[model samples]
Target: MKAKYLVLSFFFFTAGTLFSQNKSVPKSIIKQNASILKFYDKKELQSMQKGQLLVLYVERTKTLIKTLPYIALASKPGVTMVDLGIPFTSENISLLDTQHDATDKFLDITTEFQKGMLPYSDKESLIKAILFYESVLKQMHELNEQE
Candidate 1:
């Protein structure tokens, strides 16, 4: 009886330890974090080169924003990490859920100008888009200054 009790206790203790050690963050959060980091790469930000890099940045930003939902969904229970035997805490999952919603709002604001003035072929539309982007940059700069 004593030996059986010892074995049962040992099994329970090992299981508890394993379950408590699950600190894996969801893959969605990890993916977004990586893209955000790459989007803010120092070399790209610091480079003097203008037109090409600016276009590339805008495209990349749009793509990343579009991907947030899919990435966030990829971490559903029994989907990615859970299926692989890696576990994540509820706190981390909730944080990512909130962040993903915020990302949608950010994308809407960031693309407001483009969405308003789509199909920019004519000279006037082109000029308007340019002015819109300039205004956005000005506002962003002011916000940074305030911070």
Candidate 2:
């Protein structure tokens, strides 16, 4: 019985660690992916280079708004560790659930963007669909700033 209890506890700990990492991660991850943004595009990303400029040239006095609030609104279960300084962990949902089957289209878009391939040939449509993801990420950034 003692040996069995030890084995079960070990499995639980390992599972918990995996779950935590999947949910939260850390800030360096965002900066790292942001650097790879150029590679995420399949066609000429030159158009988005201009969008990058929108981020750079935008005025500072515009007042930083809460992006995480919108994100938390979407997630429904609400955020975890608003004090953790990393937003995406508890604030995002698993796409695997039935009630959230709505996330499939979004997930498919991300898979295509990251791999730089269209599962189908409709590259433009995939790119357009990817825009919805940006808003979620932007909200995560807002949470980061809030922290």
* lDDT, candidates in the order shown: 0.49, 0.37
For candidate 1, write residues 73-95 as lDDT tens digits.
43221244454454566765777
Summed over model 1, clashes come to 0
Local error of candidate 2 at residue 43 (angstroms): 11
RMSD of each: 12.7, 11.6
* lDDT by residue (tens digit), candidate 2, 8-64: 999999999877754342222111112112223334433555444233211110111
Model 2 deviation from native, Cα RMSD in Å: 11.6
Displacement of residue 135 (Cα, Å) in model 2 is 2.4
Model 2 off-target regions past 4 Å? Answer: 1-117
